[model samples]
Target: MALTGAGMSTASGIPDYRGPTGSQRKGSPMRYEEFLHDPEGRRRYWARSYVGWWQIATARPNAAHAAVADLQRSGAVGAVVTQNVDGLHQAAGSGRVLELHGTLARVVCLDCGAVVPRVQMDRRLRSANPGFAEAAESVADELRVNPDGDVDLPEDLVASFVVVPCPVCEVGTLKPDVVYFGEPVPKDRVERAYDLLELAPALLVLGSSLTVMSGYRFVRAAVRRGQPVAVVTDGATRADGDPVLKVAAPVQELLPQLVSDLASQPDDDSAEPAEALAASR
Candidate 1:
């Protein structure tokens, strides 16, 4: 099983939270509690998201994503579990992928349990607020786009911005389907990831700091089960000292080479499992 994170999509124009060139802007991200209770916070979130959504929506799969797909197709990998919500793994042709965090491509109505495509929400927001996108863009010159499709904006502008409610249930609040900080990942998603990890002989970690417990728990579980763990990322991670093989390199440059090397090796029916192979290295 392969576990991926934000760094996997950095080449595709997404920013990571704690990479070498960490988050470009500084501010607290919207918390689940604030979003649920504070109308003003929700308004600010949607206001920034209205303009920033285009960046994530238009992004394409990069080399790292394609290499993972190649590994899966070559029968080198069985399942993919990613902490990223960008849907790049699916976009790159990887199957049996588990999105640890819910995707930003969808929105849910808080009051009515109605799920809607983000594109439709974008269209509705655009129609409701003419020239708003242009205005936000002009002021966002100094702001860095976040992975969650949010950008730093002046407080005054945020106050002036308009937020659209769910179209299906007029009174319900609409929010992206992502797992927010202070919110738990869905129980079923966690169970599915654990099941995949239990079946795999090894776990390959890519582009994650594993700072959050949500992503770190899998690493701990794999270690407890005696699964060989390989980490391919550019910087320090919580699992740095634990992996059997740790490579400090960018995934975009490393994954393609790794995939090629694996493809060139002659197939050996009696070859050792991935855990043994990694442990030997």
Candidate 2:
């Protein structure tokens, strides 16, 4: 199984949290509590997220994504569990993908439990607030899209932005159908990931720092089971010292080459270690 993170989508224009080229923006990340309890916080979130929508929506899958798909097609990699909510793996034609964090493709009504497409939400917000996005365009240079697909807009710009109610429940809060930092992943989803890990021969972690327990727990599980755990990322990671093999290179450049070498190996049935595969690069 392949476990991926924000670094997996960095090449596709998404920012990672701890990578060298990671996001460097203002304010704290959105929390589940803040979104659930604070009215002003939700207003701020939807406003910034509205402007940042184009960043993730227009992003195309990059080489790293294609390489993962290639590995899956060749029967090397089986299931993919990604921490990203960007939906790039699907865009890359990868199958059996489980999004650890829920996707931004849709939004949910916190009160009525009605889910709707993000595009539909966007269109509604645009219609409700005339000229708000264009007004923020004057400070376009200041725009920085965060890891969760929200931008760091100035407070002044956010203050006047009108937030719409959920269509299904006129008063229910509309939140992106994703797990925020302070939120827990659904129990069934976590168990499914563990089942996939148990089924796989080795655990290949791509582009994650493993800073958070959401992805790090799998690494610990793999070690307990004596499964090979390989980390391929550009910069330092929380498990930099614990992984069985650590390849410090950009995955976009490394994975494609690694896939080619594995495909061409004479002993195709033999499982080549990630260290050996990376060494060929």
- Give the alpha-carbon lDDT of every model: 0.85, 0.88
Error of 2 at 270 (Å): 5.2
What are the per-residue Cα lDDT tens digits for candidate 2 across 96-171?
9999999999999988999999999999999988898888888787777888888887888899989998898798
List all candidate RMSDs to the true structure: 2.5, 1.9
| lDDT (10s digit) by residue, model 1, range 1-281 | 99999889999999877765333335577899999999999989998888888889889999999999998998778899999999999999999999889999999999999999999999998888888878877876665678788887788878877788888878889999999989999999999999999999888888988888998899999888888888878887888677457777898988887776666566774333353334323
- Those runs of model 1 whose alpha carbons end farther than 4 Å from true positions after fitting are 21-25, 269-281
> What's the lDDT for candidate 1?
0.85
- The TM-score of candidate 2 is 0.94
Off by over 4 Å in 2: 21-27, 267-276
Inter-residue clash pairs, candidate 1: none
